[model samples]
Target chain A: MSRITECFNNLKSQGRKALIPYVTAGDPDPKITLPLMHALVESGADIIELGIPFSDPMADGPVIQLACERALLHGTRLVDVLDMVAEFRKTNQTTPVVLMGYLNPIEIMGYSAFADKAKAVGLDGVLTVDLPPEEAGEFNRLMKASDIDVIYLLAPTTEEARVQKICAAGSGYVYYVSVKGVTGSASLNVAEVAEKLKMIRKYTEMPVGVGFGIRDDASARAVSEVADGVIVGSVLVNKIAELTGNQEQIPEAVAAITASMRQAMDK
Target chain B: MPTKEDLAIAKQMPDAGGHFGQFGGRYVSETLMAALQQLEQTYEKLWRDPQFQAEFDYDLAHYVGRPSPLYHAERLSRELGGAQIYLKREDLNHTGAHKVNNTIGQALLAKFTGKPRVSAETGAGQHGVATATVAARLGLECTVYMGEDDIRRQALNVYRMKLLGAEVVSVTSGTRTLKDAMNEAMRDWVTNVDNTFYIIGTAAGPHPYPKLVRDFQSIIGREARQQCLAQTGKLPDALVACVGGGSNAIGLFHPFIEDADVRMIGVEAGGYGIETGQHAAPLSSHCKPGVLHGNRTCLMSDEGGQVIGTHSVSAGLDYPGVGPEHSYLQEIGRAEYTAINDDEALHAFRHLTLTEGIMPALESSHAVAEAMKMAPTMDKDQIILVNLSGRGDKDIHTVAGIDGINF
Candidate 1:
């Protein structure tokens, strides 16, 4: 089975939701990302969403965007991100790592080559922010061939027909953007997310991961009640941003926040 | 790899999936895909619907001013002692530019789709001013996103948009230029999909946009085609237009795609020069296809795939990416794209002011410069028709500042 599928199944038997913490692969520096991934797994993260630093992150708000800028400053390329994932895989084989990014970098590297290298590097899946299913035919084919889950996002504005189409096209899980705005912009309205989740569930049996506004444990717990998984990004990325200047404080700072959300979800 | 069959259909482009010969596709987040699909559907319908066509025609004729004159530049032609040159006066349109043509069409779409608030991203604020003008006319609320740097450079147009009651938000993202403003606007559209309509200034972005903007702006070529036939008794031997995001150039070229007898050329902003590596001529110099914004197209980027900053005296043509259709056109050799340096463009800007008493927008001056160069090499009986896409009034400040003048 795919790592994303197996991870969700393991969490399902535990009567708990998946805690997926996102950190850019080379945020503060390349040397630090390996320790950060291990720390996330220690903090009860079921999966790690590694951001491949892109120049223009359109779906992201300022925090994650700045995180990308920081990573790019150190000359983090796609190969560098793949190497980080490979290094993290040595110690922690159970935790799935999903590379999250825009399409251009992968397009630059060629999609087939990216998929092959990602699978070889122990990356479980990918979530390209800008590539919807309509543009994902070749990308989906190549990733599927490589046994990697090709994830897609559904938004609050997504219609029923498109949700059905996206769910059918995607694998492992469908990320539900809980708010109308970009990442890190606002807080989630749990009731509205619950309502949207009910409609989304009608489309597919794949686990639905709610993100885009799940900042703290309270919001994570609230969304975990209705969602199959709770993905926390910008808020944790904001922590990384706060510690970007300091070299040593990043992993602990990021893990401490992830642990809090983990504790909240477990409780 | 693009198939030979795919290249054959640049004329009947976008194929249902929005691929212009493997270049254009709706490469946006899922949040915007539904909107793009809806837009494509709406456009496919309204573009054929007689009632919608009548409404658009009415607005063009009465509100925005249609059939802008195609005047023969007699004095400029004689001075060069070469091909006769004609100018399609898109400058005479409402809002003092060709931008209003697309804005009026998109504003009507917004009205049809029941979107009460419209948003746009601008470089020089001409598109912002044009969009604000349309929103005011249609009683819709409008907001414009512009880069902080551009908001300062194009300060007069900033004031003009505000005077039109647009809320101009200054974007401070990545390099703070037109590309950044577009990224911010796309984010806003993804967030506010229900009520807000994004009126993209250029014919770039994802699907249906290049096609939609071209369909609307093709009035320039359609009129020029008939006007040329009526005046000179044959289609012009060549067509020239400046390309930033290629809306004006495409609008002027789409109707003539089948006219093998008529040659087409697109001029890109060369900034300093192509050799200096400070220009915006993606197709002419640094032509490599990559995805930026929402479509696969020729882009200006570093080796790491990060879009780099571009420079041009004309703010509108200073973007790093061109329309995807332009990429397809370049690949298929249906049209030729070249570059004009900042000095060459500025020289044409002055030369036109002296010879024709018409001040060309710096964005349009690229076309003027190229046309002058090509005109001198062709027979005097041959003709070149240039899409004078806008007036130069908004650019006077930048030109004067360069010339060490206060105003």
Candidate 2:
């Protein structure tokens, strides 16, 4: 079983919900990112998702977009993200780190090279926002060969036929988008997401992580009730944006949100 | 020298690795790496599929009004000496440009793949309009990304697209033009890969798109060949076409690339001059071989790979890159490329409007300028065919202001 699957199984065995904290790698600074990754794990983050900053991030909400813009302005590329992960692996290797972002940067670096590099750098999985299940052959092959999981996204608009294809292509876990529009849009229907999750369960045995608008503890707790994992992106990116260039506030902000999410999911 | 029979033989053979000589290949993102390969393999399989060919050919002929008129420019020819100029009138196409020929075919392929929506980027708004028109016809939702500047300059087209039921998105990032619009469209394709089909406008982009779009647009040359022979009893001495992303040029040139006696000329937009640092002449300026928006082709950039700004009276030809096929033709010495300055294009734009009573698009006027140059040097009996890529109706206001003409 994959680390992500194993972690979720452990959570399920303990009757606990998973807390997945997302952070844009190299946001603010790379120096602080490694430590922040450790802090998230210490503060009760069940899984860590490191967003690889891309020049054009269309799937991102405004908060994460700003964080990406800030990271890109400071010269963050896929190589930089991989380097950070490699460094983090030296001290901490058990926590699963999934790289989430657009495909261009990875395209700039060839797929085989990227897959190999990702594995060498201790990446557990990859969730390319743009590559759908039908188009994930070579990427999935390379990831599987390198012992890395290839995650797929299940959207509200996804059809039943497509769910089978996505499940067949997917590994680690399926990311279930809670809304129809870009990130940060406030039109998520939790009941609709729960219904989609129930539908998804019929298609795949993989864990389902619901994200896109899980902004606070209440929302996270609400999603965690049905989902195997509650994935929070915009909220964490917002905290990073606020703490940028101010190192002292990074840990405090990240810890408070992580603790709150942990408590909310546990209850 | 290949005879018409020999040319037909060459066309029968699929390009090696789906390239027209050295022009096309899969130069794209790792995320799309698998998708493009799958598409390429599928295209190869379906290229001979009777069902796919029948559907594509039927749409081209019945829907797009294929075999666009081969009109003799008698008046314009009389004024430019006795040299007869014939226009393969692609402007008469359904969406008022040759772009529709490709979009319709690609949209069909998108349907075949079961994609839900079609997405594209536009500059002159011709391609966007074409994609929008086809998407509506095929019952697919269309989203067109355009540069904010182009949205303002080509307002009429913007309205036309909206009227056609496409969601017209004005891209506000990057250089705010065609190239930037292309970047945004690629981003959207990456994000919505599950349900979206990226209908690229030109014979550019990465591997399969340039080759696929060129083949779709090749109906122009295929029909023009039969019509030219039927009308004039022979092929012309020269083929001239404008090269923005070089779709129209390649469409016209591909059918005649091996016809050793037929000369091919591609006109680039020379905003000022090649040395003025303000032109879109990618072949003549500081362009090197690099990959952008999926294709390996000539790109105008500085030492640091930052795309430089380009200037042109025509928004469509203002792109900083040329089609990969054009780059290949240049390297192999099969075609000659020249530049038409803004002043010369403006002059030709008015001249065609006044002399021929056919208002050509400013992008097409670049070919008009080159035809004018070639006319004077050729013998009176020598014939030339110009791919009238699009109608000038979209460029009237810009031309009027540039020429200082009241009407």
Candidate 3:
């Protein structure tokens, strides 16, 4: 079984929703990111999504976009991101690390090279926001060959046929964008998300991870009831931004949010 | 010397590995390779389909106001010199720009493909308005991603799109401009490829889009050729059009590309100058042969391949890249390109408004400026046909604000 699948099954067996904390890799600082990743896992993160900084991140909200800009200002690239992941794997290998970002950097690097490098570095999956299932054939094939899952996102606007296509192409838990807008636009309609999740469940047995605007504990808990995983991104990135100039406070903020979210889900 | 038949054969032949001369070829992620191949095949099949052609022709004629007038700018021509200058009035088309001509065709194609929603990125809101106009007409859900800055500056157009029932998404990432909007649109297309159709506004992007958009837009050149022949008894001495992503220019230039007697000039936006790093003249300055947004074209990039920002008084022309076919035309010496700074374009904007009583878009003003410069140099009997790609209604506020006046 894939590590993501294993993680999902373990969480299911324990009757717990997966706590996925998204952090921009090399944000705050590269020296601090790996430690933060470890800290996130210790703070009850079931899965960790490492956002690779991109020059033009279109799907991201302002918070994550600013985080990406800060990371790139420090000269962060795909190689630097993978090296961090590889280093993180030295001590913690069980947590599934999904590299999420746009497709340009990976395209520039070549898919086969990226797949091999990612697998070698203990990365389990990739979530390319801009690569739909219809276009992801070659990338998915290469990653599948290297035992790297290609996670796909299904938006609220996605139709039944598209959901089926995404389910067939994807291996790890499918990410469901809760809103029609960019990452941190507004609060999501929990009932609407639930309806979409119910529709998604009809097509795929793979766990669905709901994200995009699930900021607070209430929203997270609302999503956790229906989704197998609740992916928190903009909120965490915003927390990092608030602690910018003061590096010592990042962990406390991240831990506090993660704990709050974990407690909400457990309720 | 090549025979007519031989030239036709050459035109039909896909350049070494499916390029349009040196301009077009697939430079995309391996993830997109299969879909692009499929799209290329589908486009080829549709290109030969009689039904598709008939429908496209019908829409171009009725919906988009085909055979848009070829009006002689008598006053402006006389002012520039004794040279006779004509304007191919693409602005008179429905939705007030040449962008509608291509969008109408692509929206029909989207319907044929069974796509429920149409997605696109717009720079000046002209393309967005055009796309929204067609989506409303065709009953397809339309989503147009635009730069956040553009959304604020082009508020009237934003409202126009909203009124047309199309969602205008503000893309705040990456310089908050045309290139970023294009990036967002591409991401949306990638994310929704199964059920969405991307109606690209320019003759750029991947192979099939460049070819498809040009084919649709070529109506401008084709109509101008017939109109010129009927009116002047021969083709004009020169064809002048502005190059944003080179859509309007390519549309006017394609039919006359083989006419040896007719010279072609592509005017680029020079915001200040090439040296100031505040210009959108990618073809004239700050660009090298590179792959960006799925097309191997002239792009403004740093040494490390990071795409750079471009500036122009014209929001539509503020792009860091030019179309691949324009690059090829420049390389093969079939066309000449020149830069027109903001001041020159503004002068032409005012000149056209006062002299011709036709306010052209800042993008179209670049071509008008080039025509103003070229007319004086030409012989008294020489005629210049300029593709007035869009009306200046969207630019009035900006022009007024810049001059510290209001209309």
TM-score pick, better of 1 and 3: 1
DockQ of each: 0.77, 0.08, 0.11
Measured as a fraction from 0 to 1, the native contacts recovered by model 2 come to 0.01
lDDT against the true structure, each candidate: 0.90, 0.81, 0.84
| Per-candidate chain B TM | 0.97, 0.94, 0.95
Instruction: Write candidate 2's Cα lDDT for B1-407 as tens digits.
Output: 33666556444433554454534455443335445666677776777799999998888889988779999898888777856899989988898999998898888888888888999999999999999999989899999999998987788899999999999998876568998788778767756777888899999876688788888888888888888889989998999999999999989988876677888899999998888988999986637765566655677755423356788878999898888888877766677899999889988888988888888888999999989988877778888999999999988767666558855
Task: Write model 1 residue lDDT over A167-199, tens digit each, in one string.
Answer: 999998999988888888889899999999999
lDDT winner, 1 or 3 = 1
> What are the TM-scores, per candidate, against the unseen true structure?
0.97, 0.72, 0.72
Off by over 4 Å in 1: B1-8
Better of 2 and 3 by DockQ: 3
Per-candidate RMSD, Å:
2.0, 6.3, 6.3
TM-score of chain B of 2: 0.94
Candidate 3 wrongly placed segments (more than 4 Å): A1-23, A34-52, A59-64, A73-246, A249-267, B1-10, B13-43, B187-195
Q: A1-267, model 3: which lDDT tens digit per residue? A: 988999999999999999999999889787778888888988889899999887766566678878988887887788888999999899997899999987667766778889989989999999987666544668888999999988888876566876887799999889988876667877889999889888999999999998888889999998999889999998988889988898877877787899889998998
> Clashing residue pairs, candidate 3?
none
Candidate 1 local lDDT, B1-407, one digit each (tens): 33445434666887788788879888888788778888989999888999999999999999988989999999999989999999999999989889999999999899999999999999978899999999988889999999999998899999999898899999998889899999999989988888999999989998888889888998999999999999999999999999999999999998888776688899999999999889999999956788888999999877667787899989899899999888888888878999999999999999999999999999999999999999889999999999999999998988899889995
**DockQ metric, candidate 2:** 0.08
